[model samples]
Target: MIHSINNLLYFRQKNPGIRGSGISVNDPVLLPVLSELENLKTSLENYLSDKVEKLKIEISKGQANFPSILHVSILPRNQKVSNGIYVVMCFDILGRGILVGCAESITNPKGLNTVIRKQRGIKLNIDVDGLRPTTKYNNVFENPREFYFGSIDEKQLLDHISLSLDIALYNLGLAKKDDLTIAEKADTGANDQAFDPQNLADARTKIARQITARRGQKSFRDQLLRAYEYKCAVTGCDVVSTLEACHIMPYKGDQTNHIQNGLLLRSDIHILFDLGFLTINYKNKTVILNKEITSSYYGQFKAKKIFLPKKPSDHPHLDALKFHNEHEFKQG
Candidate 1:
C-alpha cells in the first residue's frame, strides 16, 4: 500500500498537468483509498490544530512567539531500504532533497546507516516567505514508536517547551509584577521587632494586660463615616454631621476599630439602634428594626440590604456578624 501511494505521489509530481488524461487516476478502487487517506490526514491535521491552540494560549499569556523546532529524536527509519530509496521518500514527503553524496562512506552498508550518515536526517527546507509569522510546527512521523522515536521523554520535552515559552514571554513584557511594596515595608518592620522571642512574648503579654482597657481608638462616627465614604449606609445622605458610625456590636461590647465593625447610619436610625430600637440578623446579613418605629418609616429600611463594598471579599467580617447575632439580634 505504501509503495502504491509512493508511486502515485511520484507520478503526480512528474506529471502535474495531467489531472484528466483519460487514465485511471479516478478509478473507483483508487478513489475510495485516496478519499480514506485524505480523511486520515484531515483528522490528524484537526488534532494538531487543538494542540496548536493550547500552545498559542500559553504564548499569549506571556507574549512570546512559539518555538521553531519540536525535536522527536526517536523517529522510525527503515534498515532494509537503500540510501537512494530513503532520499527519494524524504524528498517526496518533505518537498526537499536529501543529500546522499557520501553513501559509500559507511563501513557496514545498512540502509539506516547509509541514510543517517549521508542524508543529514531528511532536510525539509520549508519556504517561509509567503507564510504568516505565527505558524507552529506539527509534522508527525507515522511509525515514530518503532525506531529511535520511543526513546525521548515526552513529559521532559513538554516541560522544556513550557519553560522556554515562559522565559520568552517574561522577556516580552507579559508577566504581571507584584505591587505590594508598602505592605512589604510594614511587614518587614513588624518582623524585625517580633524576631526576638522576649519582645514577642512581651508584646503578647502587653496585649493581654490591656485587653479590658483596649477601647475602639476611632469613634463609631469616624469609622462609619470613612467606611461608607461619609454617606448614609441606608439613605446615601452625605451630611457628615448627621452621619454616625453605628456599631454592629456596641463600642463597650466589641472594641475593635475595624471598618467592618461599623456602618454609617442616618441620625434617626443611629438614635433608634443606640436605644435598642433596631438590630441586625448576622446569618443573612440583614437589618431588623424595632416594631414601634412605624411601618411607613421602618418598612422602608427593613429588609433593605446594607451598602457594603462591591467586593464580596471586602464584605463586613463574619466574626463581627456572629457577635451581633449572638448578643444583639432582637429575638421574637
Candidate 2:
C-alpha cells in the first residue's frame, strides 16, 4: 500500500533543500512522482465515480510559486464553493503523504467539527513549506488540517481521504450518501437476489414497448429515438431505458435541439460525451476516445463508425460535431 509513494519519499529524501518550487508537471525533480501521482489520480476518480453521480474531481494545474504538490480537489458540479474558494485534499511528499484542508476560512465551524468527529482520524498541524503560508501558496492548502495515513492499510487510507472529501462536500450541501448495505452486498455476494442481465433486458424492453404510447412534444429525446430507430448510435444498443438523447453542442435552447445537433447515445456514453472523454469525427463519423479512457471498457468503441440513421437529413451536424471535438473533447 505504501509502495504508491515510495518513489516520492525517495526523491524528497535525496533533495531536502531543493523544494522543486515549480508548479508545472514538467519540473525535472517532479519526474519520479509522476507515475504514482497519476495512479492515485485514477484511483480517486474510479472510487469516487461509483459514489457521486455528477462529480467533478480536479487536480491543481500551473500556478507560479506553488510547490510541486498534487492538490486533488473534489469540486461541486454546479456551484461556487465557499464564495469561490475550493476545498483541497493534497498529497504532500515532503510532509505527510495526504494533507486535508480547506482553501479558505470555514463559514460553518459546527458542520466542520461534526464531520471531523465522525471521521475520528488523527489530526495534526500542517507544518510543511507547501502548506504553511496562505500568501505564497494561495491555491494550495490553506487553513490546513492534517489527517495521518502513516502505517495504515489501503482500505483505511481511502476511507480517511474519502471522509475528508465528504467533509468538504457535506459542508457545501453537495454530499451524497453511499448505500453501504448495497455496496457490501455487491462486494460479498451476500445479496439474497442475484443480478441477472435478462432483468435489465426485460426492463429495457418494457420501456421500448411504452415509447409509442408516451405523450410528449415530439421532444428532442423523442425525435432522436425516432431518428436513430430507437437504438444507440455508437453501440447499436436497443435498451430504451439506457438510451439518451445527447446534444452534440451543449444545449442552449429550443434552437439547439435540432435532430442534426443530437445523437442517440447510451446513458454512460452521453455522460462521457458531455464530459469530453468521448467524441466523434464530423467527417468520418468514427468514434474517438480520450487517451485517458483508452484502456477502460469504452476503449473497444475507438475508431468504430457510429451507426447512422437512414435519412441523410437526420445525421449529426458537421458544425456541432466539430465544435464538440475542438472545444470540448480535445480541451478535456
True-structure lDDT of candidate 1? 0.39
Q: Which runs of model 2 end up more than 4 angstroms from their true locations?
A: 16-25, 64-69, 79-87, 101-150, 176-332
| lDDT by residue for model 1 (227-270), tens | 57767777777755456656666655444555677667787877
Q: Alpha-carbon error at 141 in model 1, in Å? A: 85
Task: For each candidate, give its TM-score against the true structure.
Answer: 0.31, 0.38
Worst 10 residues of 1 by lDDT: 140-149
Q: Give candidate 1 misplaced runs (Cα > 4 Å).
A: 1-223, 253-255, 294-296, 311-314
Compared with the true structure, the alpha-carbon lDDT of candidate 2 equals: 0.59
Residue 159, candidate 2: Cα error in Å is 1.6
lDDT of 1 at 217: 32
lDDT of 1 at 140: 17
